[model samples]
Target: MWAKRYLSLDASRPAWAYALDAIIANHTTKSAKAARPRTKINVFLQDWNANTTTRSGLPVYARNLLNTAKKHNLSLGAIKMDKNLKRKLPLWYHLGADKHLKKLNNTTISDCLREKHGVTTIASLQRALRGEGGCDAPIYGQESVRDNCTCTTCQDLRGRGCKHPRRCRQAADRLLHFILPKWNPEDATPGDGLTLTRRRKRRNQDMLETSEGDFVFDPSVTEKGELSEAFRVFVEEDTTRHPPALRPARGRVVHQGKPPVQLKTSSTVFNALRAWKSAQEQMVSAQLAQDKSATLKKR
Candidate 1:
């Protein structure tokens, strides 16, 4: 019965429209799980795909809506009513919803979709499916071979480097990647930034090595000074490049029953590595201190 109505939908309606209609039908029929918005969306996508020749995967479309709604505390009803979001949401749902939705309010999917489809619209979607090539279709507008576009909106997007919102929230991560010097975590530190990269077990080669990536530090955890010091250590390790003047003194480390080890005077690679480790530890400590103070204030 639902399939017949779905098939009867005017071919001109947008993809999201089809999704919305199916959801409403389920509610009217008192379908099990219709009370839960997420479940309704999931069931609607499933029924739509099974009945239609062109099937959008159930998981893909469901994830796109659920994850985005989660970030903004949006009800599924709100998304259905917002035409601007309706325009953006389908493309995100169609191509790369899961990747972009992992981060709260991430727009990587939307921006990249624009980069590929050149500002999608309902008409564009129909044209593309029919091989008519809408908006950014090569026969229509233009394509960006260089990952950029010439339109005013795209020009602004490119100028901002097309970085997603998640990148901006990652301070310690950016610091580890050597993209910036100062990162101030907005909240308590999560943990040490070091990641175990390689573990080698050979004759007397028991040493375990670690490395750092953007995920190593949660930006919500550190302060600006700590991030700067970590980035500074990254610059210091490059002996081929001249060292910046007035380097910070390396703290001493003492192993069980072993004499103290001085970080700065150690082998060039080891010196930088130790400095980075020290900075990571300090940043974590600073984060903990901040969290404690905030807790006290609340009390």
Candidate 2:
């Protein structure tokens, strides 16, 4: 619960997702069938200083909440703010640095060129950075070795200033692939959920014109999740638009593998949880039966 407390917007998700991350994270972590006791979640919605224009100040809402809590055997309590926090609790462990906190200087640019583009020398860097249609403009940025070659492609590329004219479109393609900024999962703004992603070359790319490298090495980061979420929203929306299309959604069985842990350990944990739940239910039923008998006797 403590690890999940800060799942609310921290620093990793897009601004468009305000607290959806937290909401989804909570839903997912609890969805797993487990018998462990979980901390009860309470909505503390006392707008101490609510807007004056709102109907019936805020006390009425509090009273309504108390009535609802009582009806459901829920505890309703309030805590007063003792002191101001210097910084937000969630931001204390926010992912990625603030944009203004760090600036890219020549060092960073050079490092990025060297590591990602394999430009060892300043000369190669200038040629590599020529971008799109300059001399020797092949964006084989993923090459591990950086030796010059006289292959037909390389020579044909060098001989002609810009290769697009002589069908040296690969050069143009290199620029086309990287011209648009790639989506870094690290840049996922923390918006209230447990965010995670892995890096793969040529994974996050989009281009105005089609090209060879215009494919995502991984789609789970953006495509699968985005499309799945969009699909869910589409289905969840009011069917007033197309009420006839509504029907019970059939569920699909994905995978049925055991947890990726030692089989013995997993079995032990499962058995313990099962036993605990059995005992808990038994005790509750016995207590209820005894209470009922006592009430009958009293009557």
Candidate 3:
């Protein structure tokens, strides 16, 4: 009995001994599956100070997390901030940091956490707060290029204009289509709103009252260099002549894209438009009155 319990058993062992070995094997298999080892992720830093330094390499980890989330096409729940960061870190890092230390420069840190590398989670925060010593270089800044750096940060710093003409064209089309009806009601045909027609050039445009004076380049003029410049100048001049209620206040001069001019029809065209709208209102009022009188007579 002692040998059966203590010593290893072979195939020649008794049936009771075999049954005991089977039970032990089943328990060992269950334990192995239940307690499968997890792959541990290690965060290491040579000399990072959490209390003094602006960076803690947490941004690197945050960036990794963001990439992983994107690779798997997962949407992390909304960014949350731990409230204890203010007490843990210096006041400078807490600039614009909210009650829960959620934001930096009015942008949510959690948003940056998912989009770019930045101090995000508690682990990263601890790393930053506990960081001891490191150089004061920006963790991620404009990388040096041989010539004409095209990285977004460098391009923005250099005030590089948008090279993509399609985006500019789309924005221009949206504005032109939106303003075309207000500028010339005659040219607005019944069709999809995307379509527009430009008035043909008349023989003489000396008179301001004539159709020649009111000529605007056709929608196809956007494809022409000289005509497009002329159109742009006309738009800028006309919009600046009168301030519209909806026009946003001009602050700084932006060189790229279209200028912020709320271009509309010239004064003569606008006056005619106003008169036509007034006549429409009167016609609607007269129709309503006639219908009301007829209904009363029938009653």
Q: Name the top lDDT candidate.
A: 1
What's the distance in Å from true for residue 33, model 1? 14
Q: Which stretches of candidate 3 lie over 4 Å from their true place?
A: 1-258
| Deviating ranges (above 4 Å) for candidate 1 | 11-107, 110-153, 156-299
Residue-level lDDT tens digits of model 1 in 131-230: 2321241322233123333545444544555543222223212222221111111112223333234331231133223332222322221212211111
User: How high is the CA lDDT of each candidate model?
Assistant: 0.33, 0.30, 0.30
Instruction: Give the lDDT of residue 250 in candidate 1.
Output: 54
Number of clashing residue pairs, candidate 2: 13
Model 2 lDDT per residue over 273-294, tens place: 9999999999999999999999
Clashes of each: 2, 13, 9
Worst lDDT run of 10 residues, candidate 1, spans 179-188
Where's the lowest-lDDT run of ten residues in candidate 2? 78-87
The alpha-carbon deviation from the true structure for residue 97 of candidate 1, after best TM-score superposition, in angstroms, is 12
What's the CA RMSD for each of the models?
A: 25.6, 28.8, 33.2
Best by TM-score: 1
lDDT of 3 by residue, 1-299 (tens): 22322222224545654443333223222213222121001111000111111232234433443334334433211111123321222221121222332112223322322123223333333332222122122232353232243444434423434332222222222222232221211222222222243223332333345544544533331121111111111133233222223223267833543347877679999999999999999999999999999999999
- Can you tell me which runs of candidate 2 are displaced by over 4 Å? 1-185, 189-265
